[model samples]
Target: MLAPKRSWIQQVVYLIGMYGQFLKVYVKTLVEYRADTLIAVIAGIVAQGSTLIFLTVIFNRIPTLAGWDFYELVFMFGLAATGRALNQTFFNAPFLLTGYIRNGRMDMMMVRPVGVLFQAIGYSQELNGVGQLITGFAIMGYSASHLDMAWTFLSVLYVGIALLCSAFIQFSILLTISVLTFWIQEVRSLIYPITWLYDFTRYPLQIFHPLLRGLLTYIIPYSLASFYPAAYLLRPEQYGWAVWGVPAAAMVIVMMAYFIWSQGLKRYSSVAG
Candidate 1:
């Protein structure tokens, strides 16, 4: 006899349960190397904190960058950092797909009952991402309190939606780049340059050359993750359209990443073979 099919809600709950089990295993492993975990957390905090410090110095020297004040820039930086932190914490394992493919581990992953992406994420947890999350929210809270924008319930809702969508956008971009490993065979070198694109979202897009701005907005769409959302939040009258674009961009990028991953999966070859 055939088994009953699961409802969509049941499937989601089952997936969540699987992820929870993965998290428990990872935490057990993390506890075995407490010192290393502490060091990683500290390093993550310092790295993200230093960026805020550098921006503070820059703002002190110049009143504004393309008409955005220090607090406004901090808001943008915080949003970008928060999105990146979530990506690193949950989806960072995909970035190491090159190593997995080259080492024949992806073959093992493919044999698992669960989805390959979920298995990869479960195997590749970055505990230090907690530090980035802490720093990102601290800066975001401080900046939001200082900003002159009127605080309304809807405004809060908008920020919450924007942040969630931005995190998805960042994750999708990383996954799409990681998928290139299947064809390239070794793509570890591309990781840093791709991550460096986040720096563009830490400031007002207006400061960049028009062509570069177009690239960041269209080809890469990194600006949609932070800059556009920030613009919509701080000056809605001028950039309110971003309120719609942020979610749209997230959807488009995620679909694109999934398509790339599926295509790449067809090209995957086991290293052992």
Candidate 2:
């Protein structure tokens, strides 16, 4: 006779436990490769640092960019960085999907009992993201000290929700790109240009031309992750509605990406075969 089927709750619990185990292995790997992990973290910090340097140089010349003060822009950058760190830390495995597809690893994953997407998501944990998280929070804290912002309980709660939504949006986009590999089998070229568009989100959307702003807001929606949330926190009266919209956009994008992934999985003809 067959074994009993797990309930949805039991399945979720099992996945969570499995994910925790994967995370422990990742931690162990990081510990074993201390220098490599440190270098990776430093590279992340330096990349963000370069942006900070650019911001400093630009702010020195001008009081504000598109009506946003230096601190305001920094706050937005920090928000973006934090969201990106969350994505890199938890959902970066999509970047490695090409290899999995090429090297017959996808075959192994397909034969496993777990959901493929869950396995893909938990495949890697990036230690480098820790550096981005450090800088993101530090910059946000420093900027908040300079800005005249209120830190009410509601405001803090909203910030947490916004960050989670932002990470979800980013992960959905990456997952969608990875899904394309299921069809075309090579999409690294497509991923970079698309993902690089997120840099536009580090500053105020008001500075960009109407067309670019529309692209960022609607098509890519990176601005929702960085600018809208920062704007809402900085000036709630002006951008209060975004608190609702961010989560809505995240949910929609994630559902859409998951649908595409499901379809792609069905269409997938394993490279091994």
Model 1 lDDT tens row, 181-232: 8777666678678778888888888888999899888888888888888888
Note the residue pairs that clash in candidate 1.
none
Q: How does candidate 2 fare on TM-score?
A: 0.95
CA displacement after TM-score superposition, residue 149 of candidate 1 (Å):
3.2
Q: In candidate 2, which residue pairs clash?
A: none
Taking the tens digit of each residue's C-alpha lDDT, what string does model 2 give over 193-250? 8888888898888888999999999888888888899999999999989979888888
lDDT scores in order: 0.82, 0.87
Residue 76, model 1: Cα distance from true site in angstroms: 1.2
Candidate that would win on lDDT: 2
Clashes of 1: 0
| Backbone collisions counted per model | 0, 0
Off by over 4 Å in 1: 1-5, 27-33
TM-score for candidate 1, please give it: 0.90
